[model samples]
Target: MTAQQPAGGAAIPQRPAVDFGRRYITFETPRFAGRTPRRTMIVCAALALVILGAGLASLTLGAYEVSFGAVIRAIFDPASDPDARQVVFEWRLPRVLFAVLCGAALALSGGIFQSLTRNPLGSPDIIGFGVGAQFGVTLVMIVLELNTYLWKASGALVGGLLTALLVYALASKGGTSAFRLIIVGIGVSAGLGALTSWILITVSVEKAMMAATWGAGSIASLGFDQLAPAALVFAVILVLTLPLTRRLPVLEMGDDAAAALGIDAGRTRFAAVVLGVALIALVTAAAGPISFIALAAPQISQRLTRSNSPMGTLPVMLTGAALVVVSDAVAQLATVPVGVVTVSVGGIYLAWLLAAQYARRA
Candidate 1:
């Protein structure tokens, strides 16, 4: 125990720094207990290894067989094997990169939203931003016929921002609560989903088919052309997000407590929402609303690390990358879009979450 002198000159007991091996590490301050940077880095390394293994498996086991040696050679020296070069560099690599980036973005976004609302169910997907992005893409791709990467991306960003605005407006009338935001979000999401469906229904058959494929959320056709822009945006937004997340744990103590701690809970919440929405919208534009990654990744990361926070941002991001990359690989085997796989898997997980919540309440 450590002692501290206050204005009253009384010493209060404080827990000393604790390190529980490589598995867990933390330190206690006068204010709160938090994970050490080293512990977070270890978790990140472990998750990165999983993503790397999964990515390598993805690169090797595809439509055309390529040896591990061939993959390495193709990556390092593309001219050695034309087939390997084309398959690896021109095709598989972009898909894998998009999956990893998109997954990380969604996972980070989910963590922010979950932390802000203090609810497990509060994710970008559940709160309607995903649907709104889709709606925006539908308008750009189907109606405007400006289906280029940049245009589609812009549409998704605008749509997601609008949806977030609406959700905030509805929930903030009497001051926002997690429950109110979720309820309003569900209604907004349903409405936006219907609008997307209607757009699909009204388009020409050719256009409808194209839109449907995009909606299914396949990263198969994307190249560096799409990946570069999305990556740039994600990188910039992530830089902005990291500073805000330091204040996120403060909100868990409630608004008044957070205020007493000299944190602006409302401004922090708004910044978080804006950053989170931007992250998800970029992914949706790059890969279509891939579904449930934002919902599942952070929660899964939290459980794995046994952390009190919904998800340590780094772990959540790496976990999301792993989840999406692995799921993309599985979806490839089935010759289906990754979204199909995620939705099916996420639906079951959501059901289990609901059941557990009910059982706990009962």
Candidate 2:
């Protein structure tokens, strides 16, 4: 590769193309430039298709038994079977859309933390953030007796941020390391779990039951009332997160190296933690603490794309959305909470991941 002489008679520096045995497409502009693996693009496309197919499949699974055609018509045709339209639009569509939003939000949060910690196990669910959010929402519902979306969202956001700060403070004792963070987080999560349990036991049976159901994490009862606000918050948090995507990978190179590159490691990490917690809070507020999608989605996407970079946010979110949509559909068939389905599947994934990590160490 060589610099090309332009019409102005000046040599325009060109980035030399390097082949690394894998095909990649490059793009450049005055404001931005990057290369993407072909495999990543394909995997992302496939995941998007999976989310679409699974979401459509989910729409037809309930007791009302809307046919595939009916589902499509309900969405597009105003005059198509008023009853079917009601079932799909008013009832089922919200749940399906919520599933996608929650899944994507969780996955993005997980990716942010994992990238920050540079460890596969660094997820909001594992770090007690989800538990903290659950605890907050529990207090609001059981003690404050406020069940509105705003109250729950506020509780979740505050609780998750507090928990994240505690974990970070504990882990940062001698400068935070991935292993220390995970260990401290696990301890915090366990203590919170015990406290939540104690609170449940002391509360009235009705309140306890309601808390337990929400804690188990189900989207069955959620409709537009919750979805609209959640979606709005998600959009805002996502915009804040976009700038971090590029900076996060730089921080992965370590604080000194990132500093040399003009990236503020401390500020970036703080923003990542806050935005990540907000993402978790958003999901926990509406759907309760749906677990494991955050833990598994990013890793699954990384493996599917075979990319080392944690910047592949879109594919990770799609993977999560697909996972939740499919799992929700399965939950409908079993008449169980979506959280139960994810926990069952995610537990297996966790086991496999731990085994792999152990084997590598051994």
Predicted model with the maximum TM-score: 2
Q: What tens-digit string does per-residue lDDT give for candidate 1 at 287-339?
A: 88799999999899888776778747779999999999999999988989999
Q: What's the lDDT for residue 178 in model 2? A: 98
Query: Which residue ranges in model 1 land beyond 4 Å of their true spot?
Result: 1-42, 76-79
Q: Mind giving the per-residue lDDT tens digits that candidate 2 earns over 130-248?
A: 99999889888888999988999999999999999999999999987999999999999999999899999998999999999999999999999888888988999989899988899
Every model's TM-score: 0.88, 0.93
Cand. 2 TM to true fold: 0.93
lDDT of each: 0.87, 0.91
Tell me the lDDT of candidate 1.
0.87
Q: How well does candidate 2 score on lDDT at residue 138?
A: 88
